[model samples]
Each structure stands twice: as structure tokens, then as C-alpha cells.
Target: MDERTVRKTISQLAYCYAVNRRVSDPVQFSIAGLTGKAEKIFNSYPSYSNWDVNVSNKNLDELWNPKQIVYLTADSNNLLETLNEDKVYIIGGLLDHNHHKVFEILVNFCQSLDWKKAFLNVIPKRKGIGEEILSEYKKGEEITTVLIMLSLSGASNQPPGTAFIWISSILAIIVDCLLIMTIGLELEKSLFSYQSLLNWPLVECIFSSLFAINFFISIWLCFNGKSFSDDRTSYSLAATFSLANFVQYTLNVIYHVRTWIAEQKSAMQVIDPRGVGVTSYGGP
Candidate 1:
């Protein structure tokens, strides 16, 4: 059928599910059991007010009992199942354009069903948040850029400097070792005792070794492969430097949340000039 026809049919089905008294007729078949709790909730807040019901009821008399269910053919099985469980069979098609809202309602309705009783099969339409995906991607990109900037400007600057220092320390250690060996050889031929041959050289070697180890570890962490990805690597690298940049990001997020919470709290705490914090305060 044409899109308009399908939409119209779906509207009719929604109406039947929502407001049509015809759909209230209790069916005999029970495939899946419905829980008493679900029944109570359904009874409390009937689905007759749903927009789907209004739209559907406008077009057809028998909302759920259409001669042929045309719109949302794929979801027919699940819909039937749900209806049978509720002991209320729907004949009209389900509104598909505003499917996200419809799915939520369906979920709530299903939750109210009694699990003790099984009913006929019903199919539900799939919903998507395609529009939100692009927004999320943009948000991530903005955060990554901010992180990169903070890393370059703040104490996180040590990442690059630390790398250079690490290399220099290694070279210094090598040179000190060679000097110690040469000095020891020279003293062996002279009046100087072996212990005195390279007294200062030994001390220098010990200090150089310590600096070398520390610098090497820093470089290892700086170049670790974890932050090399095309998408988030830049931000991850910033996180690795000085640890302060990482802390900054965490604090920034916390600050935003706190600000929001404070605003909410302040709004809640607002009182009239009489010092009474009540909802009855006059207009601003």
C-alpha cells in the first residue's frame, strides 16, 4: 500500500489501542500469562489517551480489528502477542512516523503485562537515534581539542622536555662509564691505590645510573602505544603528561556538574522576601 494509506491505517490501529471501546472486548486466547501488577498499572492508566489511538480512531471504526493490517506489517506479530497477553486484540495499524515515542509506550505497556499468561505473538517496531550520533561525535571532537590545547600550555609541557632529558641522561651515563674505566687504568700504573684510582668516577657513575633509569621510564611512558589512535590519541597523549592535565579534565567535568547542581539547589532554596522557601513565591 501507499505510504499515506499505511500511515492512515496505523493511525486507526493506534486509535483502537488507545480510545476505541471496541478493542476493550476481552479475548479468550491466552498464550503468555500477564502479571497482576501489570494489569493493575494498565487499568490505572489506560492507553486510550495515546496519540496513536486518537489518530487511528479518526480513520476507522474497528481500530484493532481491521479487515487487513497493512501498515507496519513487520511488527504485526509482536503487536498481536502483546494484545493477546492483555486479552485485548488490536485490529488497526501502529503509527510508525513517531515511532520513538510509540516504542516507549509499548515498552511500558509490555512491562504491565502479566507474565503468568502468554498471549499471541506481537511485533514491535525498531527505533533509532541516528540524529543523536552526529551530535555525540562532535562533542567528543571538541573535548579532544580542548585537551590537546591544555596539554601544550600547562605543566603538561614536561612530556616533550622529559623525553629530551631521558635521551641526554643515557648519553651522560655512557660517557661516565668510559671515564671511570680510563681513570682506573691510569691509576693502576701510578702510585695511586686502586681504591683511590677512580673515587669520584664511581660516585658519578652511581648518580648517572639513577638519573638514567628515571629518564628512561619517563620516555617509555611518553611513547606508550595507548595514545596513538587517529581519533583520540592527541587527547590521550595529553593525559599521559604530568598527570595534571588529566586531573584538569576530570575537574572541569566535575566543575560543570557541580555548577549545575548548585544552580538547581539554589533554585530550590529560593525564598520569598519573608524568608520562607516555598513554591508559592510570586512571579520574578
Candidate 2:
């Protein structure tokens, strides 16, 4: 059969598998025979003598053979060999594991040749089979992204922004130390209090932490944005943004937790509300 006819057959077989989610009898039988022949060729090679051939042969025999066994196996093998003689002998399996093995064999064959030459060789057949698979994959990606976006509606946008603020604050805090050093030289005392060493001004701390978190989050968002922009499917965009938003939201939650803890500590230090003579109820 001509290359076009062979590819058409493979496409029809692939379509059956795609729709049924399992290899049909014709495709399965063809693949089994092809696998057997490939095993024979592989075992015939002197380099693979150390490997067990019986096991492989038995496995190949067990697999189903498609009706167009001769055309599919022989043509695919020849095409792969013609494209890359060095790696053609390694090709094996047309239907196993979603045809991933066959695809890899094709890629290896393509990689052996120059890109233009490989493209010329594969483009025609790909027009028949590869394009169909790519179209399906793209469609699936779109649907998945849309679902993800819908699920992440409640996540806040502030976390990423706040993360950025926190990072900047950290840098500023370092600079502040230098300033304190200069002030200490002018006066005999340190610029900030002992308490400041452990806990700087809460506003600066909070804002700075937020800035740092937001900076990284913004970078992540930009990366995800670029990824989603390349494919305008709802599923892809939704998934990308959902992950980015979730990370940002998590950082914000952490920030809030820390703030809450600080508030609790501050509240504990306040004077008693009862207003009795009790000054500091807790023991020293």
C-alpha cells in the first residue's frame, strides 16, 4: 500500500482507539504482529544477546495484531529506517500504552535527521494522523482550564502583591541597619530600642513581608499569564491562574496568621480592664 493509504489506515485505527478508549481487534492484531517482527529484528542483533528474547517474544505474541499487519509494520519500519538508519532498528510497538512507544520511535527517527528534512518526511503523514491528535489535546486543555478557574473564585489577589511588599521591606530593613550604625556613631546609644531588635515597627514589617511575597507571586503570575496567553482556551488559562492565585492566597493566609499572633501578644501586654490595684496579673 502507498504511504498515504497506510497512514489513513493507522488514523482510522487510532480513531477507533480514541473513541473506544481501547484498541480494537484489527489494530490490536496488527500491532501484535509488528511487535513480533520488531522483536525478531531486535533479538537478531548481536549487541542484545545478553538480554532475554523469549520473554519479549512471548509478550509480543500475546498482544493483538491488527488486520493490516504487513502494511502497518513493514511501512512504518521502512519509513523510520529510511529517515534514520542508525535508530530505526530500535523502533518497537505501535499500540502499546496509548501508542507512546510508537510516537517516541517517530521522534527519535526525526531527531536523527535535520529539522527541515525530517519535517518534509513526516509532514504528509502527520497531516493525516498527528494533526488530529494535536487538535484533540488542545481542545481538552481548554476545557480543563475553564473548570480550574471556576473552582478558584474565592482566592484573594492581595497575597501576591503583599508578598512583593514583604521582600522590599526586608531590603529596607537592611538599609535601616546601616542608618542605625551611623546614628550610633554620633551618639553613645543605639539608634533603635532593644525591643526593636526582636520586633521592628509592625507596619514596616507587615508591608515589607507583603511586598516580598507579592514580588515572587507577581513573577509567578506573569509566567502563568504568558503560558495561558499562548493558548486562549478557558481550561488552560483557568488552571494556570487558579494555581497562581492559590499560591498567592496561601501566602496571604500565612501573613494573616502571623499578624493575628502579634495582635494576641500585644493584647496580652495591655493593662487589666477590671481596674483593680492588680498591676500585671501574670507572674514575671
Candidate 3:
């Protein structure tokens, strides 16, 4: 990595770190397998001195516990369904087009060890910056990939720390967080138990929100038109599919909350058979 590339990479890394902190939950950041070139760049930027950059030559297997590992690969086929607080995510360290090679090798190495492994898909299925850490930087600008892992969670429903956030997924996550918060508030004020909220149709809300955002954005673009960019086709397809899916998953999340509340009210009467007029409010 040249001096310019190192500086740009650090700036992007800093931006990613800042984004993670903005979420309700923040991800922990660290770098491993640092080359001498990268080290010199880090030394130049004293501001990032506190960053956890591990220089150990220990292979990934010896360094991290397999049970707690989640590898964020550039491959789309390995989409991750969910994220947990207990796991540590491993991302590739090259910023350019060749980044997938490292992750592929790492995956094979882990498999060779017979270690139980979990793969996650954080990046979008479409072509683009799968590891979004380098999104802000211009193409052909100085770039070096850094491996970051979120071992713990302050994140919301999904993991907070990510190298990339798909344009489509970002909308869905924001909407999901809002829905969860609203439902939580409703649950707190009433006599309902946690069990009642169990199949609350959250997945429907996620898809609905994702599609709605995409549909609207696409419609707006069609009217206003879009400036030419490298990834136009993927963006167009995302918009088209979003519009189609929007109407498909229209089950209202609020309806489920109301139904749950109504059920709780009926059950409350049975719990207070004496008719003492006792009702429950959320307590600290």
C-alpha cells in the first residue's frame, strides 16, 4: 500500500467505525495480518493509534475461537440469515477487486481444520462493494482492505458493525428497528407477556419496508432520471423488484400489536378473578 492509499483506507475505516457508533449498538473494530507497508501508514496517522491492530503471525484458526466466528465473505451465495452478539465476524483485508481471494482461502483453511464454521452475508447479492468499507473512496484511489470484527453487540435487531450496508437492506433495517421499538413500547404499557409477541410478523414488515423504499426511490428516479454510474443495472433491478415486493407483503405490524393487546385484556380479567380492578403497567 502506498502512502496515499493507506491514508484513504484509514479514512474509510474511520467512516465505517463512525457509522457503527451511530446505530443503537456499536461494533468493535480491529485489524489483523498487518503487512509492514500498512504499519507505516498507521504510524503516520497518530489519531488512529488506539485502534486494535494485531500484528501476530498466528493463522486465523489458532487466533480465533471457531464457535464464535462469522466470516463476512464477498460471495453472495453465502448470505447470512441472522447475526448474534456472541460471534466474531471476520472480513477480508484487501480493498480492491481481488479481495475475495483472501476470504476464499480463509474459508477453505477453516474447513480443513474440521472446525465448525458459520458464514454470513452482510454485503448485497448484487455486484458492488461487497465489503463497504471502501465505498466513500473513489475507484483507483489508494486502497487497502482491513479486517474488522464485531465480537460484541450494542447493535439493534441486526448486527451494528458492517463493512458494507446494502442500499436496499439499509432501508429495511431502519424500518425494522422502528417497528421493534413501537411494538416494545406497546408491550411495556400493557399486561401482555413476552410470549404473546412471539410470531409478530416481523419478517413481513422488513420486506414491506425494503420494497416500499426501493419502489419509491425507483419511481422518483424514473421521473427525475439518474446520472450514469458504474452500477446502474443493479440499482435499477433493485428498484423494480422492490416495487413488485411492496404490495406482496402488506400485513400491518400495528395490527398484530393491537390483536396482542386485545388478547391480553381478555386474559387480564381471568388473572384478576376477584374484580379488584388491578391492571399492569410497565415497571422498572
Candidate 4:
């Protein structure tokens, strides 16, 4: 990539890396278009040194086997249905409005240029951030098409980050279960005593309401994961939310049943043995 282009997109790259780091699978980046002068300038950036950034002067044909190289373009008609294994996807390192189009056309159409057949058979991507040949995109922009390509091609897999998320999700479920149990116990206590019917403290009511709202929201987000994206991370997040909700809802139902039983017992105790008079119990 050109030094200027890399400078402008380095922050975007970092953002994408940050987002992908928390997820299951992340894409790797390599700089392949750097010339001798550009390479010297690129080495000055500290950001490039932090990650596994590869720099190469050789083009795709020289760097990779022709069979293992797939050019991803917005101009081609060949749609990528799936990702090929052990293949290096060649995306334009420079963000340009098809500035290479003239060269591509001259190569394909005219015999004047020294064109090789290696540049043929490009795959077209139907969707992207916005344009077909985007040299630049907005901040925090997600590369959905690339993700899909990786997933389809089998390049996508659950990395350590994904496993970490799974662990966190499990922990969240455990904490939620404990909260549900606490609520259940409180419900049982209130069933026997008339205290549950009394006005609750504003702070306590607010906390409980907030928790309930959070639970419901978690459920909604998990179920709607597909509406956001079809990535594995989204699916896992949805699964975690669903499992947690199931546990919470089931425990809540059990708590209600226990409360009903407690209420029945209290009513029986207040009734007189002779069945002639009713005794009033002390309020909780």
C-alpha cells in the first residue's frame, strides 16, 4: 500500500482490529504494494509494528501460486459463492475510484499492454460499505463482505477471543441464575407475610425494575442477532442470551408457584378451627 493511503487508513485498520479482536475470527492484513521508497516510510509507523503485518514488494502472482490467488473486485461479474481453501484473497491495497480500471481495460482489451492471463478471473462482491470501488470508508465501518467471504471460504474460525466471550457468557448466566434464586426466595418470604403487598422502597423497586428490563433486553438482542449479521460471534452471543433468559424465566415460574403455595398456607392458618370465625394475622 502507498504510504499516504496507509496513513489515512491506519486508524480504520486499528478500529477493525479492535472490533475483531473481541470476536471469534479476525482477518489478517498484509501490505503487498509497497515499493522501496514507500517501504522505508512505512517502517517509521509504530502501529504497523504492533501486529503481524507482512510487507512484500512482489505482486500476487509472484507471491502466491496462481491457483491459490483470488482477486476480489467490485467490477467483475463473477460472484463469490464460497471461499476457497488455502487461497490468498487479493484486494486492492490502494483505495481508488477504479483508477486501475483503465489499465485493466487496456490489458484485457488491447494488445498494446504487456498483460498476462494471471490478472483474469476476478470475483465480484455484491455488497460492501457503500461503493463498488471504495478507496475510503467511514469511521468504525465494518467490512461485512470480507467477513462473509472469510466465513464462506472456511478461513473463519473461533479464535481465542471467541472462547473468552464464551467464558464471559457462561459467567453472566451463573450470575443471572443467582439473582433469579434471590428473587425467588424473596417472593416466597413475601407470600407468607403481607409485606410483599406493601409499598416497596423506591430504591429497591427501581433496582429490581432495572434488572428485569436488562434481562428482557438481553433476550431481545440475542434473538435478533441474525438481523445484525450472520457472523459466528453474533450467533454465539444470541445463544448465550437465549440460554440465560430460559434459565431466568423458568426460575421465575417456579418462584410464582412457591409463592402461591405459601399464600394458600397463610390463608389456611388464619381460618378458625371451628369454621365459625376468622382470625386476623399480624401484618409483615
lDDT of candidates 1 onward, in order = 0.41, 0.41, 0.48, 0.47
**Candidate 3 residues 1-284, lDDT tens each?**
66677766656566555544444534455566655776677667776766543444355667778888777864665645344567777775545443233333333334332111211233333555543434333231222111112111111122222324344456666776788667634534333344654444444555556555554444434323323343355345544555456444445545566678888777665435345554453222
User: Which portions of model 4 miss their true places by more than 4 Å?
Assistant: 1-6, 9-16, 96-284
What is the C-alpha lDDT profile of model 4 across 217-261, one tens digit per residue?
443443343455444756455455455545555655665677689
| Candidate 3 deviant stretches above 4 angstroms | 51-59, 96-284
List TM-scores for all candidates, in order: 0.21, 0.23, 0.32, 0.31
List the candidates ranked by TM-score, beginning with the highest: 3, 4, 2, 1
Best by TM-score: 3
TM-score of 1: 0.21
Which predicted model would earn the best lDDT?
A: 3
Q: Summing lDDT over every window of 10 consecutive residues in candidate 3, give the lowest-scoring window.
A: 144-153
The TM-score of candidate 4 is 0.31
RMSD of 3: 21.8
